[model samples]
Every structure is written in C-alpha cells, then in structure tokens.
Target: MTEEDIATASGLPVYTWRRRHGADFRARVPVINPRERLRLYDAAQATAYIKGAPIPASPADDAAHPDDLLSDKEAGVVLGIDATTVRAYATTGYLPPGTERHGRTWWTRRSITVRRDSPDQRHHSPGRQPGDLRDRAPRHRRDPRVTEVSALLLLGQVTTDEIAEHYQVGRRTAQRLLAAALTVSED
Candidate 1:
C-alpha cells in the first residue's frame, strides 16, 4: 500500500501521517516498485512499520548488486552527455526508468551501458547543407536611406532640410535619418 493507505488503515489523521510520520515511514519502508511513479509497499511490512515494531529483514537474494546503482549525473559521465540530457532520455524511454529514493534518482549500470553501446547512440553534427543559410547574413541589416544620407552629409552636398525635400520625408524623419547616418558612419 501507499503512504495514504498505511495512514488510513492505521487510523492516523492524514496531516498527522504526512507532517509527523511521513519521513519516518518512508525511511522504514522500502518501495516494492521502484520503476513506477506510484510507490508501493508490502502490506505486512507497512503494518509492521505503522505499529512502531521492528520490520522483518527482506530476502537478500532479491537485492541488486551494491555497485550496480548509479545516479543520473554519474550515468551522464559514463555516457559523456549532460545530466539533464540523461534525465530527458530516461523520461523519453531512450533509457530505462530510474528509481527515486531519498530524493535522489538512480539508474542501474546495465541499463546505462546498454544505452551507451546501442547502435544508434553515435551522433554526427548536423553540418551546413544546401540552402541551409540562404538569408542568414553575417551582419545586421542597415537602412539604405541612412547610408545615402551619411554619404551626402560627408560630401557637404545636402542639409537636413535638403534631405527632407529630396527624400520627400518629414523634418523629424530627416533629422532621425541624419542622426542614424552619423552613428552608423562613426561606427
């Protein structure tokens, strides 16, 4: 049963079970289904834990190898990928699901190795392809008006009023274009 199940079965208030006994209960009970999000515990073991009695020792034969467990970061180091990517793969079923215990997620060594050695694990950088960068210019786009204004002002051939008349624009627009031209030319 779950924590709520154990609490309700033992006649403890929900909040009391959570705020008071939650950590203690978790510490005492080993979840039976580690691969699943919903944690499940043996009914007898849950009862034993709830009664404040010593829980029986489970079978040692069914236990995982002590050195087989690895955290996601450790798995990432093994796979040469970022920990977040490792976690993403796990969640996306590219890797085996991890077990959460004591607020840490762990994956088995075998599962990580299987993913690491898989045929499709090798990746290539998606390099430049035909028509890949048709419009990707190296520099920011500059206004043609600004360039023309800059050249005319540099040649001392036109005033802002002349620019306004030539470009058929407002006085404020001429002033702005002239200012933009000055800044662009200075740069």
Candidate 2:
C-alpha cells in the first residue's frame, strides 16, 4: 500500500504516522515503491495495524476524496460549511494550507475531512444555530456558476476542459451540471 493508502486506512497524515511510528511501521512492512515511499501491506494486516493505531486529532471521517484533492467549494461540501468558512479555516490554520493555482484554492480533501471529523471542529464551527431555516430548507435554486457553465457548454463555444479549469470542478461535475441545466431548459 502507498503512503496515502496507509494514511487513509490509519486516519492520520502520513507524516504524522511516520513521526509517531515510522521506524517500527517501516520495519514491519516492506517498501515496494521507493519513489512514492509506498509500503506493501496486505489488507488484513493493514486493517489490524490501522485498528491498533491511536486516533489522530485529525482523522478522516470517510474515504471521500481518493485523489486527496478538492476545490474550496468541494471541501466546504465535505466539511458541512460554506466556502467562505473553508477559506477562513484555511487562513486560521484550522484547515490545512492550500495552494493557489489559476486563481483557485486547491486543498487536500483528506486534511479538510480530518478537520471536519475532528473534535476540534466543534470549537471553530461557524455560527449556525439549531433550527436555522436555511439549514432545514431545500435549496431549489441552481448554482449560478453551474447555470453559466451550462450555457457556455450549450453554445458549444467552450470545451469541457475549459469549463473544468474555469469552474474548478471535475469534468464529470461539469458534464452533469450541463446536462442538468439542459434538462431544466427542455422542461
């Protein structure tokens, strides 16, 4: 398994795991991909090791982002907060640092998820009280960006890749948004 895979299984950052138990863990497992520093561990052994490890302060809630990457909005969705809150968290170090590429902030979903699932989140959660109408209601309105992307797609003037680059979503999300918009228009 790769370092990332081990991280996913253990619910800890690879670096944190290494810092805590690197020597022992490495001695127990054989390195298969030296370039990636990946170690080979079968499923059963990996599961047992993961179960035995101490839970990190930041632990992944679920295996949500396999690629370990996400746009701010995507991270927000996973974090049960808004994009603005996500940015704030990133700025305050509540969330992991992100890279700004092409005017968009890209974060590690693993880190965001860890923060989300971590107990520390309760202290820093946004001020949304119980019985908030916005939280209870369904947001029937489509995202404006999705609508705009769909229009550009229907015009056939912009490629899907361009839409993905512009919108900071995956090609599949772009396609689905376009398809949904087209369906709505047809209706």
Candidate 3:
C-alpha cells in the first residue's frame, strides 16, 4: 500500500507515522494485515480501555490493620498535611519512626489510623493553631523568593530550585513561596 493508504488505514498523522517507522512502516503494514486495525477500532467502540486501573480489593485482600505502616505521602493524606510537612514531621521526630527498606521509608498505616483516631495524638497535625508561634515572626522575615522564582519561571527565565538556591533556602520553601505567589496572583 502507498504511504497515503497506510496513513488512512492507521488513522495516524501521515508525517508522524512515516517519520517514526521510515520505509519499514510500509512493509510492516501489509504483514500485520489491516484486519487487526479494524478489530482494534471495533474493540474501542465496544469497551473503554483504561490505563493503570487501581486493583479492586478482593475477598482475599484484607484491610490493612491499624498497626500497618504507610508511606509518608499516605500518612500525609490521612493527617491532612502536605507531603513536605509529613517529611518534616518525620525528620523532627514528631511522627512515629518509620522503617527504611528497599530504598523507601514506610510508616505503620495502623499507627497513622490510631493517631488520627486518638484524642491525645500529637503528630502530623494539620492547620496552624490560633496561638501559633510562627505568627510572632517579623514582617521582614517573610521570604519573597517563591514569588520571584515563579514570576521568572512564568516569564521563561529560571526554575524552582534555581530561585531557592539563589536565596539559599530549601526547595520546599521555594515551592511554598511559589504557591503563595500563585494564590495572590489568582486573587
């Protein structure tokens, strides 16, 4: 089949498929036979094909008990804090110590659930209290790096960490700066 015929049959942009496969594309199209193509189209019409579907919990899949450790991200979601905050809490020894294995750290999912459910639990708490000590910071202590970095990025100049390093601050601080800047810009 001609290049035009191949493009029409495959429903791909002619230039892209041709550039990708080169001359071999022409030879393979006839070998695969257009029957498979038609079958694929029919399948597309009959059922939706989803990529990366979450595995359904089966009868054999037991609910993770309260003692099960979770990842920092999962714990953060349960505690309603950002992933960075969760990491910070872990670093500060606020959260129950997690175990490192397979190059990853995991918290007990059970421990998280218990902390979340307990009235006396104190780790990974979200939201600033009314009497938060951070409120005592002077107005001059406010960092403007996130704003500058985000503005520069929007203008296609610098990246997130570039701005952070420029100000000698952590990347998370830079990100928070950007988020705050975006919020203000949106308002």
Candidate 4:
C-alpha cells in the first residue's frame, strides 16, 4: 500500500502522516525498491513501524541497503543518546564498538539495537568465557598460607608481634594486615 493508503487506514490525515511523528517513522522504513521516482511499501510492515511494533524478518529487508552502515553520530541518534556519549560508550566497553572502516568507525543498526533485548536479565558478566586455568592465574585463590594466617588472627592464637616474626614483617605492617583482614571478614 502507498503512504496515503497507510495514513487513511491508520485513521491519520494524509498531511499528518506526511509530517510529524509519522514522518519520522517513515525515515526508519527501508526505502521502497526499484530505486524509482515512486516507491511502494508493505502496508502491514509500514504500519507496524509507525505503531512501534516488532517487525518480523523479511527478505525485502535483507535485500535493501546491503552496505548499510551508520557513523558514530547516526548510531547515537538510533540509540537515543548524544553522539559523544555514544562514542565514549562504544570505545570504553560499554557499547559494541563498530567496525573501523575506511579510516572511520561505522555501525550496523543490528549491533546497536540488539543490546535492547532483556538486558537486565543477563546472568554472567561480559568478556572472556569460562575455561582453563592459565599458568599466570591460580587454579583457585585458596592459598593455605593466607587461610591459616587469617584464621590465627581471628582466633587470637596469634598477635601482631608473632605475625611479624613468622612473616618477617615490621610490627606496624602486620597490625595493618590483621586490621584489613578483620574488616574483610566482617563483610
């Protein structure tokens, strides 16, 4: 259906549909095919776009704009935030950093929009996946030495002086370590 047909079916006046929020919605609609002077759109999909409804995937969408890419500023608009904020978030691991192409960063619409899916319900933290223990990192942090020292300090079986002697540290340093361990155990 044509834009006018959509306006009429949606109970919006043609002029209103051609302006205001409806016009903004049109900007998001993939341009109608044939690259012609006049274009056509799938009526239901166009209406869905205007109504803020989820659009089902379609072949036409895949065919259009094969090289579609948004610059940092355009991505910011899609994300409803300022450009500088988008740039910072993308660079600092907060948002997906778009590909650096032709000496500039460009983002696909999917990269920015996919982040909106059930974000707060996520289970694990981002970055490296769970797996093997590299030599650089311990298999686990359960060092018996630390556990024994912490236990001795907690049970009053050891004092700052004794801890200093065993660990070969100054009395002041042992006292500080004991105090820190106490505070952590409280938490």
Candidate 5:
C-alpha cells in the first residue's frame, strides 16, 4: 500500500498522517521507502496500523455534533432552533465567527453553547408601530450583516449560490453583497 492508500484507510491527509504518525508507521513497516515520493507500505504493518489507529476528526463530524466544532445545522440542534436561524446568526455576527473549510462553515462548539445560554435580543413588543422610535433609525445605517456574509464568502465558508438561495435574492445581489462587505472590511 502507498501513503495515499494508508491515508484513505486512516481517513486523513497523507502529510498530516505522516507528520503525526510517520515515525510509528515507519518503525512498524520496516520495508517502507522513506524518501519515495509515493511511499509504499508493507501490507501487514499498514493493515495493522489502519485497523488499530484511531480515526482523525473530520469535517463531517461537524454535522454529527462533535464536541469541538459544529456545522450550522448542528449548532441549530444544540440551540434547539432552525438551521436557517443559526446561519443568520453566524452570517450577521450575532454568533461567533465560523471557520471556512472546503466551502462549508463550521462554528466552535463553545461559541454555540454560549449563544444557546445567552438572552435573545430580537424580541419586540407586539403593538410596536412602524413609526416606533426603534424604527426611526436611518434606513441607510451600515448593515454589518452583508459585510459579515461577504467575509464568510471571502473566507470560502459559503458560496454565492448559497447566499442567493438562502437570502432569496438574485445571483447579482449575492455578489454585490459580498463585494460591498469586503470593501467595508478592508477599510
């Protein structure tokens, strides 16, 4: 088996597996060629390593509600809210910033748990009128939501198509939102 083969079996990148477990793997697989670009593994030793080694944490674990990181949907589950709301909170910076990896968003479990225990700030009186003092703020107020979302896009957490679909806006609107957000952040 090659390093790629071991990586597939271990469910980790070749570099990462090598960096963390290379010495052990090499000691076990005495026949392996260390300098080879495509490192080959001895069958028995590689199989033993693959079977005995603990699998590394994966992005997929986010959706499964792991202890360290969470996807928007997983965060929703922890908070007992809808996934869309989680996404909105994350995109608007109401929730802690999320990490972008492979075009997916992942929030810290600690952040989500903290938010779940915090008070809801969006509550309003039932009889509030359109002319209420709260509503009197200028319409042109800098909406940080778009900017935050754009930052997420720039970070590669969310895609333009996702923004358009979730916001029910056009592709152009999504692009403009990202561009505007990036411009604001740069300043």
Candidate 6:
C-alpha cells in the first residue's frame, strides 16, 4: 500500500507518512527514480521529521587529530613493549604518571605520543643484551617475594588460606603464587 494510503487509513497526517516513507514510496511511485527518491526523502527527514541530524563529514579529508586514548595493553602496543614492561616503566618513573584507581592503570594517547616525540627518551642499547640467567635464577636473587613464597612452598605443607594469611595477599593471589612455584620447581 502507498504511504498516503497508510496514513489515511491510520488517521495520521499525510506529512507524517511522507516523513516516514517518502523515499521508499517515491521509489515505487511512478516517474521517480531511486536516487531522486532517496534525496527527497533525506531532505524531508532532515527538515521536518528528525529532531536533530548530524552533517556528514568529508571522507577524503585529513585533519590534525588528537592522540587516541589508550589502555595499558593499547599503550604497550603503540610503544612496542610488553604490558609488564610498560607497567614496570610507569611504576619506576621512566614514563610520566598515568591515572591509577582501584588497581587499574590508564594512559592517554597523548602521553605515549609526547613520550615518542621527546628527545630525551632513551632507546634500548644495541650492544649489551639482558642475561638469560635473569630468567632462571632463584627468587631471592630476583624478586623479594621469592624468599617468602619459596619457604612456604618448600615446606609443602601449607593450606591456601594459610599462605594467603601469611603473605597478606588474597587467596587467589596465594593460589597463583603456589601454582607458579610448582611450575618453577618442575622446570
């Protein structure tokens, strides 16, 4: 049925029908092509029906854009570093301060952009390689947590709650620590 017929039968105004189905109706109506119908309908919708409509921007245009907002993972991807390294750098003051709340970290795209543009930012050295022993070495030789968890795991007798209570960490963290220790011992 025609939009006019719909509006008439439904007791709504013809302009309402035109606003809603003017394009499609124009397409099926005699003498009107799809493009002309679409244009007319878009005009009607823009001028009479819609409360607020956005103007279309140019597809080919390039503008001075702001840096994208980034999460830790996204910032790490942009900086070509691992998430752990990014966190370490942020924690150690190598990078500028980022927003921190409830144990989550967030960085602005501008932060990374500015850091990349800065002249004083140090690039990794080419000649000196980090040691393989760094990965395989014992915990006391590396992380301070090593001494604490190693003693508990080596005893092989502590409950998860006991470990959590002793370390003042959450039960989940305690479980993860235990699992990691077991993996290291097996390796």
lDDT of 3 by residue, 117-185 (tens): 777545445657778988776665545654665576577755568767877779887677777767655
Candidate 4 local lDDT, 1-187, one digit each (tens): 5667677877889788788655675566665544434455665577787677975454464463524566676667767878898788777666778887545677777777665443742335464556734425656444344555777767776678887898888988778767766655676
Using TM-score as the measure, the top candidate is 5
On residues 1-187, what C-alpha lDDT tens digit does candidate 2 reach at each position?
A: 4555777677788788778876776666544334332234444455556677542232234534454556677788888889899898888777877986445677876677667777865466566778888788686877787668667756776666776788789999877776776776676
What is the C-alpha local distance difference test score of each model?
A: 0.78, 0.67, 0.57, 0.66, 0.70, 0.58
Q: Sort the candidates on lDDT, descending order.
A: 1, 5, 2, 4, 6, 3
Candidate 3 displacement at residue 174 in angstroms: 43
Task: State candidate 6's TM-score.
Answer: 0.30
Report the lDDT tens digits of candidate 5 across residue range 67-184. Answer: 4556677688889989899888776667866887435677888888887888875444245777788767667766656867866756777777887888888999888876777777
Residue 187 lDDT (model 6): 65
- The list of candidate 1 runs beyond 4 A from truth reads 4-62, 65-113, 116-131, 138-156, 164-187
Error of 5 at 118 (Å): 1.6
lDDT of 1 by residue, 115-136 (tens): 7887774243244665777546
Clashes of 1: 0
Per-residue error at 165 for model 2, in Å?
74
User: What TM-score against the true fold does each predicted structure earn?
Assistant: 0.34, 0.31, 0.32, 0.30, 0.36, 0.30
Q: How does model 1 score by TM-score?
A: 0.34
- Show where candidate 5 strays beyond 4 Å: 1-67, 123-187
Candidate 1 whole-model C-alpha lDDT, 0 to 1: 0.78
Which of the two, 1 or 4, has more TM-score?
Answer: 1
Indicate the residue-level lDDT of 163 in model 4.
74
